[model samples]
Target: MQFKILQLVFLFAICSAANAATLNKQVRSLDWWQHASFYQIYPRSFKDSNNDGIGDLQGIIEKLDHFTDAVVDAVWLSPIFKSPQVDQGYDISDYRDVDPDYGTMDDLKELIQKAHAKKIKVILDFVPNHTSDKHQWFIDSVNGVEEYRDYYVWANAKVDDDGNRVPPNNWISNFKNSAWTWSEERQQYYLHQFAPAQPDLNYRNPKVVQAMKDVLTFWLDQGVDGFRVDAIPHLVENEELLDEPKSNIPGYNDTDYEYLDHIYTKDLPETFDMVYQWRQLLDDYTNKNGGDSRIFMTEAYSDINHTMLYYGSADGSQLGAHFTFNFYLITDININSTAQDIANTVNKWLDAIPEIYTSNWVLGNHDKHRVATRFGVANADGFNMLKSLLPGVAVTYNGEEIGQENGEVSYEEGQDPSARDPAIFDKVSRDFERTPYQWDDSTNAGFNTGAKPWLPVSEKYVETNLKKEKADPVSHFKVYKALAQLRANPTLISGDVTVKAVDEYTVLIKRSLNGSSLALVFNVGNDTATVDIAEDVSKSNKIVLTNVDSSRDTGSTVDPSNLKLEAHEALILSF
Candidate 1:
């Protein structure tokens, strides 16, 4: 009788262990973004369907197949709101209407419907920090309209003993001028962190906050999946207009804005409170609508400690941002970064965020230099491997899959106001990175047939384009597609990530869930390297994918004892 009782107890224990594992796996799979990848589209540069030499909503609709081909789960668009084209599309003149240059309201709605039909989500860019001077609210505030007088930040000028009137404070604009612009009509100065045409909104006013929330609801009713909040840290500033202290660090360029610490001008504590309130609103919307919860990501490029705070408290009760943009990966990792350095940097970011919130990785964006140009073409595949294999959401800027480099733009052709300034012309221009996408090696690179493109196409488009790369089996575009497809595997999406530095040049990433495991090895150097994987890999493991030509041997078992890697090569193995 005693032997029989012991056997029953042992079997019950085994069943309990198996059930716990299954439950954990089920919970991890519920995160929507974990199994998805986002593609960012700069609408004005994607395609021009109206032959206006500018991209519009109709242009994006015509190329929806491109997104389907790449298997992207969502498309994130830059600002398309009505604007005067001062800062491209960032300076908004109307919060609720689509820009005439981009298209009409009906065009935007049709794009959303078609995208939803194809199982693709659409995310709009939301700019709550400021608005164009042409916006009605700003115009009224400047004109001293009773109802809108305090809608913007306005202060009286200070007079010195010498009888000279000056700006309210010594704060400087991000584009290199006084943050306070003197308004002749109102006899007071208005604050503008960016261009003078874009005036900052005063969040201290409850009416202003409610109005912006209404703007979000107006779009939420239109069925946008979510929003990517722009310049989140600049949403609120110190109430007291104070002078910023000079920084000990050298300026990034000749711009005067970089010479100061920006202590009193940006990243104040009140900004996080505003984020929390926004999150509450998003949550309330999702609960009432009854679908996948809406996502709210922020562009908070501060230190890791502050960035994590945007995700709210560690307990996950007061959630703020679903994901905070992690710029450290782009700013810290470079060609000279060793395997150990990369491992430490990635792990530090992962550790800072709590388990309740999802993490995100961004390699390229409209505001920064292209990754292919920053890191050599030979290393692009290795970087892509790292980005997709990380245990989080990966954001790929348009044209990055084909390894597009920055196009050249002379001073006369530059459109960015900050870049056009004589003092910072060559240093601050972003036109090169914001050129039109190269679809084929034909006239205008097949982006548009009408008048010349808004920005010149890259000269190398003749050889490096979608048509050419798609024809070649061993192209960077093909490699990216394969990596993106791998996200469909639950183990790769929701597994635990562990980084191991094999050597100065080689790094190994391991992801595991339940009993299934996968390993990715990258050689981020210019020389060939071999890593012994006898303990980590076995004959049972198979090479699922690789960028090295020699390692593409099919139907052959990989040797566990001696794994070889060529320069700038990456391989994925499943066991």
Candidate 2:
């Protein structure tokens, strides 16, 4: 039969030239987001291969081989679109479709071609700040329907003198009230920063920026390789007309969340020209798509030199390099207060931007609390909750590497109605950081042998699973895969560091590439601590890595004239 259809067209051109030689070897081998490790996945409590307790997209393509030996490279995902999950799926009503309760857009293109055939890289969480008041362009622009009624952010009575309706001013809505939602079918006054069923989407329209660039060019033409955005610097508001900043409230009623300072409607500056025009529309759809590789992350709750001045802000070209949320505002572990809290968050991300700007560190997200939510016991030493901050890129939060904590639920066992706060919904149930993802300790922990589970499965992660921590070796998933293979070694991902300290309880960082050299030593105190090191730290010191055991118990007490450190130990020398 024509040689069996020419042997199925030469085995489909050898599987498209082995998927374009694995995305051009992950675009000349990974470094855009400096040694990317990312692994977030909160698709409705992640995993329910048809036992119907949600979590789909064919249960993330049947666990892409559980992150093919994790400490994984990339997989962001959260917000499987088509939402009415309200704030779940970040309220979008279809940013190029998917949500049939999380499946089909061809099962998210077979979970992005089986997570790029296992070299992993998927991304997609894009909530573009707001949508879903059952989004059909916000119900045809709240019914006045003038070509989808100006896309959203409406307001008519700027203090209506006598017509009376009022709501074009006193802003607010970080999740309380008045960001205006009076929409009586075009009776004007529509914007809903959040929880007016999440309306806010008018980046002062241009057909709503060509309808969100045709819904991100329908997922980079069905191959989505980037975007973590959700609430990106609150998509541009506050175009002057000022008036906030008053209340050092140290007295009375000090908690309307301490008078929310979303700095005049969020880091404005036209929200960095709407993220440098969604990064020049995903860099012209990956330059006419071939071997896709794109990433435009954001979720800036600001701070880190104003989030590295929103990376190339508006045609000085910046928008897309936001990896903030700094460990959901601290989960502390003390390695010299975690290397001086990531050296003051990498010196405010290198003194406010422009060094080819980019930064990300997420830590444990699904809205905080779960790095054993403050040591209720789990791997008790989460290399700073598996992120080991230094300079951007590192997400980690799926049972946070065998150390899953926080899961006790009761408000009749909730499932995030934003932990229920619909106008002060005190049905009470907050931090248990979304739950479910045990991966096997069976019974419900397998995530579903079904006996109820839409959340619940952190029985201290029932003996930390991934098949009993791949059969333990002082496992925190083998120290997050030996701290992400020495933080993606090769002189630790584009190196350049110097922190020295041969004193006050030992510290020495040193990492130089292309000329090869490395040093790590960090034993911040608790019985045993001497000092003095850089005389070419010798005594044949070569312990390369140590969180617990590799035997040498402090490099036979290393010495460049007396050097020690054995409590919360660390040392990674190579030269």
Candidate 3:
């Protein structure tokens, strides 16, 4: 009887090992974006090769090995298209060519080719809502050319009761001005949701739709993997030209544009139709090329319910964006946010998205405050751990892995138009988060050899840089890289997320797939916390990774009956 019992126990161990191996293999076989990790590169701030104090495509090519080292699957570049630099690259003069400040067309093609050689996909920023006033189409329209008249939204000004000319509607621009800009040559007002230089394109024109689709096809033909659609909610506006209702609540940080509710100007139903058409075009391209389905991610910063609409309808008949960026964690989660707050917010987003669709999370980007500055260094590690372990795609802004903080930019050094505008400069300026990336501890942070960088480098580059973190075994950079590598595990990629509030400051999340289970415990508060573990987990002796010591222990076992975690620490255990 004793011999038989021992034999059964040994057989069970073998089965468990076999199952774990299969689970890992299954995760590795998932779709590219399913378990893929993305690194967002803001081109102008990434690297400079021409000694012009501006980063270019060649600079990005020089850093291709960095992505491979970090185990990133894709690189999402901000717009590098030909532009007038009025609103940076957002005001595009031409969609098919690279900006002169950045590089040439051949440079972009080479970057794509080299990235693919390293098994990394490249995604470009697509600005379909507007174009530079200098664009040929916009110039022609203003020239009274019949063929290009309707390419942009044009309206005739009206005389007010006081006999003064007024805008067609009361819609406010995002930059704190009238949405309509009077064009003297055309004797009319043109809509510009952003800056006057960026004239909003008229989606009501079928020719406009075809022209935009042609731009997508042009990039697709160049082996680009996908596009991060910019400002998707503002793609269309109400046709009735109605005035937006005034808001009773105060403006956001005293910005004038927030004085009214933007009902008539944004989040219109027609935007989804435009998204659907673009998605269909992407699918058709995939079918023709016999490659993986092209990715369509949109920037829709709305509530969970409204944001999910970008995915598709209930039956998934008219699929739109594959992944609408999930900013709930970024905007809501903070150092003071309770564990329940984090768990509830994440669960709400998970529940809102359909089962067929993949979820995504972003902690920081060029437009927002850096995660390190927003969530403190201690808490950032815990938040980053959660971001990496969560099911679906994860986007890491450039220089974030090294715990780079937001740089300080004086009024004189500010480059963003919003920062320069006297009305909104105090309330809305993104220059702090758009600083140059810190590469080393040398002068100018080793970004360029020419004049000072376009934006100042973070002051912490002396200790917080790629070279410094790469040498330190317990640095945040190493921790982030390990997390990216671990995401390849099927259990974390496809497994369902189950959360429990261990305490106000501590949270427990379990990811289970195919009878394989893993638990992630986080102490988000500023004090130590403890939680009880199940008997099976305590006895399994599975402590996979821990942020406290930056260790990944696969061979050791411990009794987790009374699991204790320091403030802002996280532990990943396997069962």
Better candidate by lDDT, 1 or 2: 1
TM-score of 1: 0.92
lDDT (Cα, 0-100) at 141 in candidate 3: 96
List where candidate 3 sits over 4 angstroms from the true fold. Answer: 1-18, 21-29, 251-255, 422-427, 533-537, 548-561
Clashing pairs in 3: none
Cα TM-score per model: 0.92, 0.34, 0.93
lDDT of 2 by residue, 329-424 (tens): 344333235445544444444455565654455556777666555433322342442244244477777877776676777665565654465444
Query: What is candidate 3's lDDT per residue for 1-575, written digit by digit as tens?
Result: 11222232343354357577666556534567876788899999999988788888999999999999989999999999999998879999999999999999999999999999999999999999999998999999999899899999999898999999999988888887788999999999999988889999999999999999999999999999999999888888888788888876753433357777888877788898899899999999998898876887999877777698898885798898888899998877776889899999889888888887888889999888899888887766777888888888999999888888888887778889766765555457888888888888887787887578888887888878888877664677776876776676667866767876788888888887787777778888888787776633546655555663433343345556677677787777666
Give me the displacement of residue 21 in model 2, in angstroms: 60
Superposed by TM-score, candidate 3 places the C-alpha of residue 74 at a distance from the truth, in angstroms, of 0.8
lDDT value, candidate 1, whole model = 0.82
Q: Per-residue lDDT for 358 in model 2? A: 48
Report the error of model 3 at residue 570, Å.
1.5
In order, the Cα lDDT scores of the candidates are 0.82, 0.64, 0.82
How far off is residue 244 in model 1, in Å? 1.9
